[model samples]
Target: MNKQMTRAFATGLLAAAIALLIYLYFSPTQDLSVEKMKQKLEKDDYVVVNATTYHQQVNELARLQKEISAMNKVKPTIKQKETKKQTTSKQKTNSYHLVISSGTTSAEIGQKLEEAGIIHSREQFDEYLKDHHYATKIQIGEYDIQQSFTFEEIAKVITKQK
Candidate 1:
């Protein structure tokens, strides 16, 4: 009686194994594996990355942008007489509205300021940016500037706009 029962149990286990194999072989959906992942990628499909890594990358990007803006600040060199002259001329200054974008470099900003008659020279303005170590500190916004503003005043306005 013991030998007969052992034989029946072995047969049942073998049958179950065969049924599982057949089910897997005939299934409509393929099993998840490296092959499936590769195929999906080859089809130009989007895949999820680790959420923490993605968030870290985004935070790093924002931090870099802020640093860049702060590093492009302008420094001006002018004599006391020149400053007095500039101050006196400010009353007759023409107004201009300028828009600065976040990704714009210091050279571009200087060029724009020069074009608007806010600064004497783009090269000088660029040098000021380098000398002052104002990288990405220039606020990204719409600004109302005037031609009569001194270089120092313009720098302060551009860098500290609310």
Candidate 2:
């Protein structure tokens, strides 16, 4: 090829490349706002917990688990069992109606249980659900829960075991 023809071809290719770059730079695009991004994540069922809160939850869960293990190690005496049975019989009338939906969270369920006097601590219940991997397995339905039910029983019931 001639030198002038080669130069013309190179310049044309360079010009086309620059034109393409300019077109890409000037193109209209959809900008994702913070709220829109958050909404999109929520729509996709993604939860973003902060690091501090997540670490705190982990520490609290560990402490609660130790306490649970200690509690489990203690055996109830016959008298304690009898007393518990009597108290449970009396508390049977205290029924809590729990409605779990698609967007329900463990924290909200724990809070509701605590408010209904079905569970002692919301934090403990939340930690238990998270620790036992039942947080994501909770079924969406109406549950007739009694105060006499233990956390394990409650978890099983809510997870569709009952």
Candidate 3:
């Protein structure tokens, strides 16, 4: 009777292992792709946050975001001061020469222009270049630009054929 019982238990274990293998082979797990994730984001109303951040303090993060919004509502506006030093600096930035390095990207050149105060925003300069398809046509050389020059004028000067 003991031998018979032992044989039955061994057969049962083998059958269970085979069943598990069949199930796994029939139903494979899936990985989420970028397109699928984008679709889910667009279709669903779920609020997503960093996994580790949410696990730590989701409530605190929400509160901080609210406080930031409140602060932005009361943000101070800039009022230009007409000091002598300010006037001198403004005059210096008016007519300046900028050197464009070889193989530099459009964003980098835009940033340089913004830093020199020849343009208001780097993003605006970049957009102007892209809209006019001059991003790839910028040449490496010295460019003389004034602070009052429009982005279009700057782009033209930078991309002109030598």
Which candidate's lDDT is highest? 2
lDDT of 3 by residue, 75-143 (tens): 533223345556677767587688888988899988887887777789978988898899999999998
Can you give the lDDT of residue 117 in candidate 2? 83
- Native-referenced Cα lDDT, model 1: 0.78
Ranked by lDDT, the better of candidates 1 and 3 is 3
Residue 77's lDDT within candidate 2 is 61
Off by over 4 Å in 3: 1-93
lDDT score, residue 156, model 2? 98
Residue 34's lDDT within candidate 2 is 80
The candidate with the higher TM-score, 2 or 3, is 2
Candidate 2 residue-wise lDDT, 1-162, digit = tens: 999999999999999999999999999989999889888998999986778999999999999999988777664565689998889786877889999999999999999999988898999999999999999999999999988888889999999975
Best by TM-score: 2
User: In candidate 1, what are the lDDT values of residues 47-113, reduced to their tens digit?
Assistant: 6566899999999999999887666543233456678777777756767787888788879988888
Candidate achieving higher TM-score, 1 or 3: 3
Off by over 4 Å in 1: 1-93
Candidate order by lDDT, highest to lowest? 2, 3, 1
